[model samples]
Every structure is written in structure tokens, then in C-alpha cells.
Target: SVLEGGTWAAGRRAAAERRPGGGPPLTILSDGTVF
Candidate 1:
């Protein structure tokens, strides 16, 4: 699932960057595209 994968990646990146709320987490629509 793109959403799950993206969100996981985003969380890792955010943690590495030390920015808990730096921006929105990645999301995916029914079309399997990030939104």
C-alpha cells in the first residue's frame, strides 16, 4: 500500500530530520497515487 509505505518512509525521514511535525505525512488515494 502506497499510503502505508509512504507514511512509514515519511515517519523515518521526519525522525531522522528531527522534525515531528515538519509537514503532512504521505497519503494515497484509491487510484494508488500519493495525494
Candidate 2:
């Protein structure tokens, strides 16, 4: 589950980077939690 979450987060980050004019900032906690 941890690996899957990491993969999903990475994919999301990649997609966000592809957005035009930049994407909103992401807040990730030290525990791997994102908001």
C-alpha cells in the first residue's frame, strides 16, 4: 500500500507539472501525508 501510494503521488506530481502556467502548491508532511 505504501508503494502504491508513492506511485500515485508521483503520477499526480507529474501531471500537475504538466499543467500550463504552473500548478498549485502541494503540501506533503514528513509522514508522507499530503494536503
Candidate 3:
């Protein structure tokens, strides 16, 4: 699961905490691979 405790989850948690809506802190590319 994406929620599993790992580097990805760590970063996700960081993003969630940084943003108001739990969204990424940066703008994602239209290609869907830049975030």
C-alpha cells in the first residue's frame, strides 16, 4: 500500500503536513510525473 511506512510514505506525510489539503507542496506536471 502507498501508506506503508517507507521513504515514499515519509515524504507523503511531510507533504500532507505542509499543505492545507494534503496535496503535494509543488505543482505537478501535466504529464503526471513531475510531482
Candidate 4:
């Protein structure tokens, strides 16, 4: 999942830079159909 790789992949170079505690990105939107 992109979420796991981008914002939730701790200690992974493929992950995006985030806050110290793995805070979510500022802009994300989805209906009730996805995670």
C-alpha cells in the first residue's frame, strides 16, 4: 500500500520524511472505501 510505504514505513528509505512520531501527511483524502 502507498500509505504503508510513504507515511507508515518506518526506517525505510522509500518512506517520505515525516515527524518524529510518524505523523501523517498534511493532505490526504478518500471515501469510506479505502484505508
On lDDT, the leading prediction is 2
- Top candidate on TM-score is 2
Of 1 and 3, the candidate ahead on lDDT is: 1
lDDT of 3 by residue, 1-35 (tens): 65555766665556555556545534332223333
- The local lDDT score (0 to 100) that residue 5 gets in candidate 1 is 88
Candidate 3, which segments miss by more than 4 Å at Cα?
A: 1-5, 21-35
C-alpha lDDT of residue 15 in model 2:
58
Predicted structure 4, TM vs. truth: 0.20
Score every model by TM-score. Answer: 0.47, 0.54, 0.43, 0.20
Candidate 1 clashes between residue pairs 3 or more apart in a chain or in different chains: none
lDDT of each: 0.51, 0.57, 0.49, 0.36
lDDT tens per residue, model 1, 1-35: 99998987876654545434443333232223332
lDDT of 2: 0.57
Model 4, residue 28: what's the lDDT?
20
For model 1, state the Cα shift of residue 32 in Å. 25
Residue-level lDDT tens digits of model 2 in 2-28: 999899888767655545545444433
TM-score: the better of candidates 3 and 4 = 3
Candidate 3 lowest-lDDT run of ten: 25-34
Q: How far is candidate 2 from the true structure (C-alpha RMSD, Å)?
A: 6.1
The TM-score ranking, best first, is: 2, 1, 3, 4
